[model samples]
Target: MKRYFIILAVLLTGCTKQLTQTNPNQQTAQTFWKTATDAVDGVNSVYGSLMLDGSYMRFTHVVLNTRGDDATSNSPWDQIYNCGKFALNVDGFAASAPFTAYYQGVFRANQVIESVPPIVMDTALKNRVLGQAYFLRGLYYFHLADIYQNVPMPLTIAQSSSDYYARQVSQDTVWMQVISDFTKAATLLPVSYADVTGLDANQFGRATKGAALAYLGKTLLFTKQYAAAAAQFQAVINLGVYSLVPNYHDNFTEQDENNPESIFEVQFSRSVGGTTQGWGPGDPQSNWAKYEARAITFGPRNFAYCDVQPTKALYYEFLQEPTAANQVDPRLYATMFYNTPTMKVYGQSFQATFGVADSEVFCRKYENDGFVASEFVWQFASGINSRLMRYADVLLMYAECLNEEGNTAQAYPYIQQVRARVGLADLATVKPNLTQAQMRDQIAHERFLEFGLEGKRFDDIRRWGWLQDPTKLAWLQARDPEFKTYTTGREYMPIPLAEIEANPGVIQNKGW
Candidate 1:
């Protein structure tokens, strides 16, 4: 699996040697967009950005999950703690990394979209490549808009240094751009690599029609276009391409990379040898680009830096309902490392190494069994694929959309499918004939349980309008005291001060 991404990394960076040798003073687009290989590499660079420190592979947790009620920045990293506590100002470290990383991706994608069409290559291949760029560009913007509601929307390649200073656009305009990109991508992308005539099986991780539709639905869902979002999600379901993996834990493991449930994922490789470059003080020579470093950041203090830890609220949430066998939700065991003597983490006893104290629960989702004492780099180089979208999420989102559309009765089976997978009773049986409001609450609970530590909770709170609701805000404050200072206009992250100074045209988010 790592070999596939390794080859992708090589194809992305190595194939553009001739283009890189052009005059340094000229614009990159003027010299670099000369061949089919350049176009391919351009889109590949966008994919490469996903593996960067500030993107989905790492700091996204700090920006999204840690800010929610489920987890906290347990390490003494002030920036991440500040983000989790809603104390982020313009100058904070958390604001800059993702803000820079996402725009880097947007810039790369913009070059691909603008430069690829005129190369006179195989038309189908060019369209496929452009489709990927569009998908990625939309994804980058989605992250930006989702985090910082007011963001600059730069659609074209930057021709000069001044072109970089884009003014902030409204959230509606950014979301429209996101929708447009994904819609264009869906039309150009094939349903799968198998559907493409000459593509190899190893190229399975590229953007596809299903991925575009799934993301499009997600964008719509986030913007409160429930009916339209449901249509897109149903289209994905109708395509018959994805399903839930039998074991939920398999979704997070390296062995199950690109599993049936994975609608879209950031591909990482431990085999792409280079220095680990991320937020941690790991082996500088470790292959960070090819690895998912969350394990190092989220694991126990002994094996890792332990930046983020699961909260007691999340722990008890799992115990709220037992399975038919009267066992704890298996997902709890898969998602966290508690003081259970039977649990083995990274091939060691969790209690012996990290202690059995009730207060010490670390994330276990990305921890692999391949780690050994001699290979300390494994801590930073876990090749586990990070899922960006899951079929389970699709089901829940669809269920939510249905309930929102005043079809609460029809939403039961979708919720039941997720619950039954974990040996829990059907939601319909437990809370039969629920009203629309009741079903909405149940879906929220299910999503929290299903997607905790996967970076979905914070988005869930935001979309549910919980952040603005006094009752919900109080509920969050009870679970995570960080919400005590969470104010109304501060829902979106502040524009980085560096960005504001550099791009004078760019306005800061409200209350920054």
Candidate 2:
């Protein structure tokens, strides 16, 4: 039987009792915290929430993807704008499993935070535990603010016996709190874990000070605190702990699964034999297997569905047409596989790549290993870690911040570093002659190409204030006219109706 972890109550009750592993000598918290190892394990449980709980995946998909102007489909989530029923509606932003999952993640993180301090331990160990909790708590709130502008921010545990109702905090307060947590986490976490040293090890996937700093910078940029954000990103550069993995493909290759560029990653270990498979169960498993460039886990016919093909807008960004040929940015081919004539796959010719005969326009190259079966069989196997944050992002963000502060000279080199790694040409000379708008566009484009579909795209579009730009929106629609008619009202997602109805304090985003 699969073990379903109940993470919600941990948030509501602020209780770690449920998270405590069993002990032979004592069945109590006191007995459990007899050593630093025990405390570390408890902290790991907090991070574990990213895995078992569905919040991370759902929030990235429905909440983030829906709010951004990037998509066109009426993906059930389209109701955030179309229906104007912010408080309650099902297909259109009404509450459902996903909303609940977000809260559950917050709850579990809070539980860890609440429980850790009380346990007596060495100061260093205690700080580490507390730091991880704060990191996770901030992460959850970051997502919350990104979606529901003003959301209830609960720092402590909520007990069922206590007041079940709490009010929402302003979005500004939420961002402030997020910054505080990430800053503290950056100070406390090690540059990297000891076991996973070097690009070859899986350690890069684990959270480090660099990852926290990168996120802190991201949050700052999203809020338009450009100068401050740039400094934080620069700090990562100063650490000298990471660098871009040369080939765009190396970043996602099985050999470089957790390369130096990755500041943090979601660790997924493959399941070899029996039910204890590393990648999770069934469909997610099959999807993992099929997407890999290696041999199909379930053969070609039984492959996983829901491939998350890129939109035509994204495809055009690559400019991989007959005239374009290799002219399309090389990164485009590295980031996404084109069924077009130039970059054919699986014996499928390019002429029919996106034509009616073959619907595979652009599949995620990062997700698809393109590894053929062989001694490379291990590459197709599970255990491939997803790079959540990378040094490249840090460099680009720093460049953006510098550009915003009119320090284009300082910024240009950083952007050039990333381009050079990918065998692309650097930006033009960056002196006082450069325009902020031009540099801004460079950073935005860099982010789009670098972080596509890794849960960063929509956030980038939304924060850029280009969410409602008619031209950009029109481009999205041009790729799929179904989106051309979408309204600006979707700027904020509807509060899932169930959540609004359940929590009186929660207000729906206006016009939702």
Candidate 3:
């Protein structure tokens, strides 16, 4: 069922059709919502939007990770560089892509939520379908709130042109709505597709109770509701359905995709084929649309375009805490590639000097690594699935929440589990008897190593108030230099100009 979802997702792209109806003479969308298949299709459309360029699966990395101190965009593309430099303008693709992509998902999800309930289908299936819609709606809104800060909350499907013009809501209000949607989804979703006896077990990629709970916990964590968030993370742990993959590298490879460690991931497949009709210049294959561009963009310029490179500081971070063997953390090797003769990347020997300037170091977490071959184009066409949530992340979040709740002693084991997986010593052995502040820093350090290039750094610094603290801000600036340009009011991205133009009353984010 997971494979089916991947195939289905690859074939569908963002819905270009607008939901708002300015003219009554236009064909009623009601015509398309009358069947059970429509419900399935409606939800599938939501999933399809995940593959869009602006979605979390791809470009959002610019905002999420590139903008952080750990990485910088090496590409000449203005928008990509601006993203890493925190100099994004309202009209750039960086601002508009996420705005459009996430809302496109919200629109489709609303269609399913509003139109699917009325269809007379098998009760379990109907609720399950609706569950996914609600989950997706929550997920999209969560991204919106995280990125845009202040965004309109449009819960219902738009029935008229005016309905599209939603007024911006407070970030807190948007978060509450996110929690509401995920809470409803948790109740309706099954523990797993395997639990739904009649359904295809491959329905593995679909939203499940665990996914909803994990995300609900994540949302709560973002809001600093430590006690409540810890409870939700604990509930996911109690499910006994997920665990850290034995091999840290497996989590990033195609062979181990959707493994137990993956709670939810954006599905992609080369075999499913791209949504576009023809492969353009520098395209990997005719099926370029079916794959994610992360591998290509983050890969070494010799192997790919190498748009985003790990900062030297991130490399030094791995060296900060070595394994019991006093060797570099194993995850360092798995996460990045430098010009070491002993290192082999993408089935090719590593060379100290690559064709592109400042391309000696590259991200390895999502690089193709020649696992599947399609020539140079493989950079853009790698079918590796992008993991959105991993069990390891859950453990770290749980540890952070536990520590915040004054259970500093209890947090050790959760974080230890992550370190143990990578052959690193436990926190108790290396840094025992720590104060809450010390443990909190340990958790932050651990997360930096564990989820680099996975898009968690910017959020981590922001939530920890590091970005707001002059001392910590100086630390970041020492590493990336770009941090010097960061200002308090500029943390959230600007509202896209197009959105403001469309809704004349819409206000832009503070810094913009």
Local distance difference test, each candidate: 0.80, 0.58, 0.80
- My TM-score estimates for the predictions, one after another, are 0.90, 0.78, 0.90
Superposed by TM-score, candidate 3 places the C-alpha of residue 326 at a distance from the truth, in angstroms, of: 2.7
Q: 1-512, model 1: which lDDT tens digit per residue?
A: 01111012112443333654656786455678887777776787778778777776678866888888889876687877788887876776678777777877887788788788889888888889999999999999999999988888888754454564567789999999999999999999888887565332248679889999999999999988999999999999999988888898998888888988998999877766565454422112344457777777887667677788888888889999999789999999988888787887667787777667745777888766444541255656777788898999899999999999999999999888899899998777779999999888889889888998988898888888998888989999998888898877677888877777756677787777
Task: Encode model 3's per-residue lDDT on 400-419: one tens digit a residue.
Answer: 99999999999999999999
Residue 220's lDDT within candidate 1 is: 97
On a 0 to 1 TM-score scale, where does candidate 2 land against the true structure?
Answer: 0.78
CA shift at 377, candidate 1, in angstroms?
Answer: 4.5
Residue 409 of candidate 1: its Cα lDDT?
Answer: 94
Which residue runs of candidate 1 sit more than 4 Å off their true CA positions?
1-28, 160-162, 198-202, 273-288, 354-357, 373-379
Clashes of each: 2, 17, 5
Q: Identify the runs in model 3 with alpha carbons over 4 angstroms from their true place.
A: 1-28, 197-201, 274-288, 352-359, 372-375
| Cα RMSD for candidates in order | 5.8, 6.4, 5.9
**Can you write out model 2's per-residue Cα lDDT over 102-212, one digit (the tens) per residue?**
555666567667777777667765776677777877877787787667777777765563445567788899999999989988887777667433222333344578888
